[model samples]
Target chain A: MTKVTFIEHNGTVRNVEVDDGLSLMEAAVNNLVPGIDGDCGGACACATCHVHIDAAWLDKLPPMEAMENSMLEFAGGRNESSRLGCQIKLSPALDGIVVRTPLGQH
Target chain B: MSRCPSASTLEAAPIVSETVIIVGAGQAAGQAVASLRQEGFDGRIVLVGAEPVLPYQRPPLSKAFLAGTLPLERLFLKPPAFYEQARVDTLLGVAVTELDATRRQVRLDDGRELAFDHLLLATGGRARRLDCPGADHPRLHYLRTVADVDGIRAALRPGARLVLIGGGYVGLEIAAVAAKLGLAVTVLEAAPTVLARVTCPAVARFFESVHRQAGVTIRCATTVTGIEGDASLARVVTGDGERIDADLVIAGIGLLPNVKLAQAAGLVCDNGIVVDEECRTSAPGIFSAGDCTQHPNAIYDSRLRLESVHNAIEQGKTAAAAMCGKARPYRQVPWFWSDQYDLKLQTAGLNRGYDQVVMRGSTDSRSFAAFYLRDGRLLAVDAVNRPVEFMVAKALIANRTVIAPERLADELIVAKDLAG
Candidate 1:
């Protein structure tokens, strides 16, 4: 299991232990962490699960694809660190990764 | 004017904590269960589903799942451990035999009785089938559940002949996948144009062309008179006297809202279970949501029964909020989407009572948007391969902003700027 920390817009931080094969969004959702809607069920079709990855763990994650980037553009408050939580797969290398959910996802 | 009481007003009323029972284990029920917990409702959540499996996403069943690009396990909305961890008691593969609204209890098919203080009817719709003779042949299929798609996928082999009985989104999506998998797909539509009921003729023509280019035959204005032959092979007889041989036949006519259970309980049901702005049926303490509900929308000002994942989620969230004494009405604008081949069709708002359609981009490029307007107010938009415009159009429609037809057609003006 990988330990991931999720910070909500209101500064509510939740530390969750997620299986390696699960996505970061899945981890947050499974732990009942609020603010990450995951409306499309991780299909990359909806941008409701947008999150800003911590700079330290940004390089540890895989690069965002064109589809995911396009979907994130629809989300409010997008930035260079902006990523769809569903697109990021959890792994041992990113065990201590931290991410923050944006204020508005729709 | 708000139709339901405000959250603060509802909180001021008397509070009674009791178990919440949600019927039908589909997308709406799944959302209701999660939303109840999110809304801080610590009561027991008993989710009763007629199907044996847990709640799963249905959209991919026709697209990625049918094309073999998505795995079966991924179709699940959440991990199996979610219910156990959330303290949601799931009773699957058991149908609710009767709803004793007076007694606040529900009888299961297996002779089990469950009582609840609040009941949520999220019983979604079923796929409409062909009523003609030989429609029940073994080879004929309908895509609604996991077992249904599994059967269809097994029959969809290379060079197989597939006759889709409808030209709606479901049928067309399957056609796109079947054609890519090297199957000879033929779509039979009773109307003169595909997607005529949902979209304008110009947009329907574009999809018809896309399907034809992908080697799928679309026969519009052709009615299927009957079906013949045995379990091995079938033939579709059209009103035009054309007999088309089919290795497999899948019916995607439309959906019939699963309101039988609700109606039997004396709930007010029109096209579906009649729900108000707060997703409450005529019967108090019982709420409804998802495709099985016909509710009033503040945006359209018309009664509608939407069958989109967006509506299901929003309505489910609204129902949960109301049950928790938050009482937020279901006021979100409706939106829909369809994935056919490489094109992604996204729509916002209803195009009903439209007076004009303005094209924003080149149709030949297959990356354009059509904005529908009634009088001067923006009503709806259909965006294909243009996510930016679709996003902006959603905001514009929500605000009811009116843009000149010329400006909408012009490519120089940024879509986001139009909102300003």
Candidate 2:
């Protein structure tokens, strides 16, 4: 199991274990995570499952696309470290990464 | 302008990070969480939400969910174990009261603190309530949550008097369900037609007959005076001195964005949270998504806030990418859908500024696609029960391709060439 720590927008920390190969947005939906909605069933249509990547690992993340950026125009409170959690796939290499949510989600 | 690449090809090898926070528990939030994982970000994920239940879709809340046709489990995008398998920490029923951008922390109502490098706000919208007398009566209903559906469902007893105050999709949808359930549904609209605001006159006429045929009493140019129910239940009186025997009242005029937090945080807010093409707020480090943001569209060349599942989810994805420091601007053609009785209404792009509207299907058959053209430019389309036309219209809208008005009128235009 891959152990992942979640720091909520309110600074609440929850550590959970998960199998590899799942999406980070999937992890949140499976765990009944609050802020990640994933409305479009992983299609890039809805941005309910938004999260912010910790700046420490900013260089390690993949770049966003035009579609993702275009959709962000509709997302509120975006910052430099903001990344749609659904865009990120879960893997062993992603262990110990942290993301902060906004005050609330879709 | 170069067409945008698919999100799949943009996935880069994610660097290991220590914390990822997602606020709110709506569809956009849920999608972002999954996208981050799917895109290979094995970061620590935490989702903070104020709602007690797990994240669920709200589209059905005013329709199937209220009708009891679909179970609550079906409302979930995934099964219960999906989150557990994904290792996402879900903090439900907690509200984040404050944000310290300087310190990179959030303050919870319970006096707890959560530190983050970045944050996302998917806090969606709420039903706009009326301020008339007896507006808070127990018989009043506003559909926005599962609980709201439950109350409306319970009140929809057979022969129960139903008074719908708005003629919008939510109100019309609820009326269809209620009328089918054997309740007398009366929709009171201040506008001249049921869907006068969003659709063209001809398109509006098609649905006006639909609801009228469904045993629904659609009162146009009507306004509600007040609810005169006892503390628990009663009837609705209109501004015209007409009284409808209403056991319950449902308001579906429109939605008001939950922009308090964003506004308090000093983000630029108009009718909704205003974001640029990159989904960035006037204030850097803050992003807004979903029905809450008003952004400009290249197609319309006007700022608009789309209230549809399509806008919400796509915007959420864009915000995520922007937060990740991989900026891509949001520019998808807007699309929306509404189900009323057996008619499926699908639309792509905006018809607000259009001057010409051509019909592609037979309106006599209660099905057609209304194509909106602005200065001969194919601007948008509202297709009813015409999925093929809708698909083609999406392509046309995306490519900004123009069609001969005569072919559209004659239904001779082929759709295959418009799509990939």
What TM-score goes with each of the models?
0.95, 0.78
Candidate 1, A26-89: lDDT as tens digits: 8877777888888777766667788999999998888888768767666788888999999998
After superposition, the stretches of candidate 1 with alpha carbons farther than 4 Å from their true spots are B1-17
* Model 2 TM-score on a 0 to 1 scale: 0.78
Indicate the residue-level lDDT of B190 in model 2: 90
DockQ (model 1, Cα): 0.54
Listed in order, the DockQ scores are: 0.54, 0.14
Cα lDDT of model 2 by residue, B348-408, tens digit: 7888888899987788886788999987778888887666667567667777876778766
Worst 10 residues of 2 chain A by lDDT: A39-48
The sequence of per-residue lDDT tens digits that candidate 1 reaches over residues B327-402 is 6888876888889988988888899999999999978999999999998888999989877777778888888888
Against the hidden true structure, what lDDT does model 1 obtain?
Answer: 0.87
Give Cα distance to truth, residue B43, candidate 2, Å: 2.4
What's the lDDT for all of these models? 0.87, 0.76
lDDT of 1 at B399: 85
Q: What's every prediction's RMSD, in angstroms?
A: 2.6, 11.9
- Candidate 2: what lDDT? 0.76
